[model samples]
Target: MSKRIFITGIGVISAIGKNASETLSSIKTASSGVGEIQYLQTVHKGKFPLCEVKYDNTQLCELANIDPKTRITRTSLLGIIAAQEAWRSAGSPVLGDGRTGVFSGNTVGGMDKTEHFYADFMQDAQSGDIKTMLSHECAESTERIADSLGATGMVSTISTACSSAANTIMLGARMIKHGLLDRAIVGGVDALTKFTVNGFNVLQILDEEYSQPFDENRRGLNLGEGAGFIVLEAEGIAKEEHILAELVGYANSNDAFHQTASSPDGTGAFLAMKGALDVAQIEPSQIDYINVHGTGTPNNDLSEGFAMQRLFGENIPKFSSTKAFTGHTLGASGGVEAVLSVLALQNKIIYPNLRFKTPIAALGGKMIPETALLENQDLTYILSNSFGFGGNTSSLVFKAYK
Candidate 1:
């Protein structure tokens, strides 16, 4: 049998909170971070709601303890902050032994900086600061995080859209299961940029109001920005008391039905969830709760709801999407949700799906999400789903440490 992978630590920075503790407090109190745009300089500033991290670049640098004078992208800064927190939470293990790896995911990369560079470069060929474009690649943030943590093992960056971070966690777990690494830092990050904001706006999926996932009257997703990372260690390598949860299963799939929409029948979603269950050797009924990929978009909620019904049948487990609190964080959603799942397992609490009122008629209006927080429940195995554009879907099964 493959070795078990245990989550030893978690770190996150989102609109709801800046760290794990604050995130938990927000969830417990049903506080949402979605609000009017404040940081990003865009025409949609007052037109659309967003979940920005609430920290400027200089402020983030100070929190991450990086020199303010250093030229860095917001993506890298956010990643460094979350990654450092995860490392410290994991007891600051020595990574110079070369058995630790860093796997991160993001679609935005340093577009926040790249956009500024282009604005000036387009105006004048040599006017834009070249330094601003240094961290433009998707791998730049991942590399920066690895360097910061002194990780020397396999370093990879996955950009499968919204499923990006979940895929990183899956990859890290697989590598450790195969004896490739003893420890892995896996998650994703994305800083809000004019490019992403305008892109989604052009797609007409940005909600003017706070998003309501799985709601019949849901408009669309509210864009958010942040980062989340978790530390995974081989069962034997990590201290028993430090183990937060066990990553029992993970799987990825693609529907190939549309460029930006899931299949009407949820083929990719079902396959991904089923595959994860198969890997974990568990039944669908075994899942206690689900952190669904309910993006508050009509197509996504419908598709994911159908997928869950197909898999769980009449016994669908209690589930909720925390997006209502943090907004649809795009590439960072997977990692952010992953951290939330671990928090749920750790706290035995079910976070509410905010703003949910009426259920979708297509799903018989019976698929109502958890609208109120429930504390001290029996949560064992939780399934978290992250579906991205181009039908890329991923699911992860996290089991409470026994």
Candidate 2:
């Protein structure tokens, strides 16, 4: 058997909550974080709804314990907060003895700051404080989180758009399975910025009101921002600590179908889900729940719903898209939903797809509805999907800790 990887800890910060506990509470109550934009100084403020973190930069800095005068980006600050929570939740075990690694994923990185200073920098490239652009690379936030947590070994990043965090978790699992690391801190973080908002706006996929995933009349997706991290350790090492969940199966696939949309048949989504089931050695019927990549966009919801229909057939497992609560968190969606999946297994509850109304006509009513808390349900195995731009897709299977 392959080396077992266990999730020892989890942390999250999104529009819904400042930490994992708060997020769980919101999910349980079906409280949505999507609303009018607050932080980002976008022209589309009243025109578009967003799942922006409630804390402003100053508040986030205080919560992250970052120096008030530090020139860090909101992306890094959000990551530090969530990553620190995960580290502490994992017992803050001694790491960086060359047996630990940090694998983080992100798409926005420090763009929030870059966009803030771009005009001034353009006016005077020589006079501008180049330091503001120092963290522009996608790896900067990952490095910041790793440094803050004292993860001094094998720091790296993955940036495959929305699947970034799922890929990071996959990488960490492989590293542990191959004896490259005994423990790995893995997750992704992204902060709202004018860049992403405008980008999605131009694509005509940003919902003016709150998004409704799997709904027939869904307008589009509401952009969101946040971070989530989980600590993965070899089973032997995890036995010394508390095991939150088990990482049993994971897979990544690329459809090369379209740059900004999924294929009509959800090829990448199907392949990734199938590959994950194969790796876990579990039948499709074994999945007790599915956290779908239902972004509420016309193409994404249709594609993912069709994929579920193909994979689960007539008796599709209970499934719902939590994005309606948190919005489309871009690269952090995978990590955020992964944490939710683990929480579902631990709590024996499947979260409702908030705001869901009419089901997608294409899927023949396969989508999970906004049912009451599925309390006492046998949620043993869960599959979480994250499909991103450029046809990059990933699926993670998290099981109840045995």
- TM per prediction: 0.99, 0.98
The residue-by-residue lDDT of candidate 2 on 1-402, one tens digit each, is 668999998999999999989999998887999988778897887988899999999999999998889989999998999989988888888886878899888887899889867878778877566788899998998889988987777999999999999999999999999998999999899999888999999999988888888899999999999998999999778855489899999999997899999998899999999999999999999998999998989999898878878998887888888998999889888889988998898899998988887877777765656455678878789999999998999999999985
The best candidate by lDDT is: 1
**Which segments of candidate 2 are over 4 A away from where they belong?**
none
lDDT of 2 at 240: 51
Local accuracy of candidate 1 as per-residue lDDT tens digits, 253-300? 997899998899999999999999999999999999999999899999
- Candidate 2 lDDT at 6 equals 94
lDDT of each: 0.93, 0.90
Measured by TM-score, the strongest candidate is 1
Query: What's the lDDT for residue 376 in model 1?
Result: 92
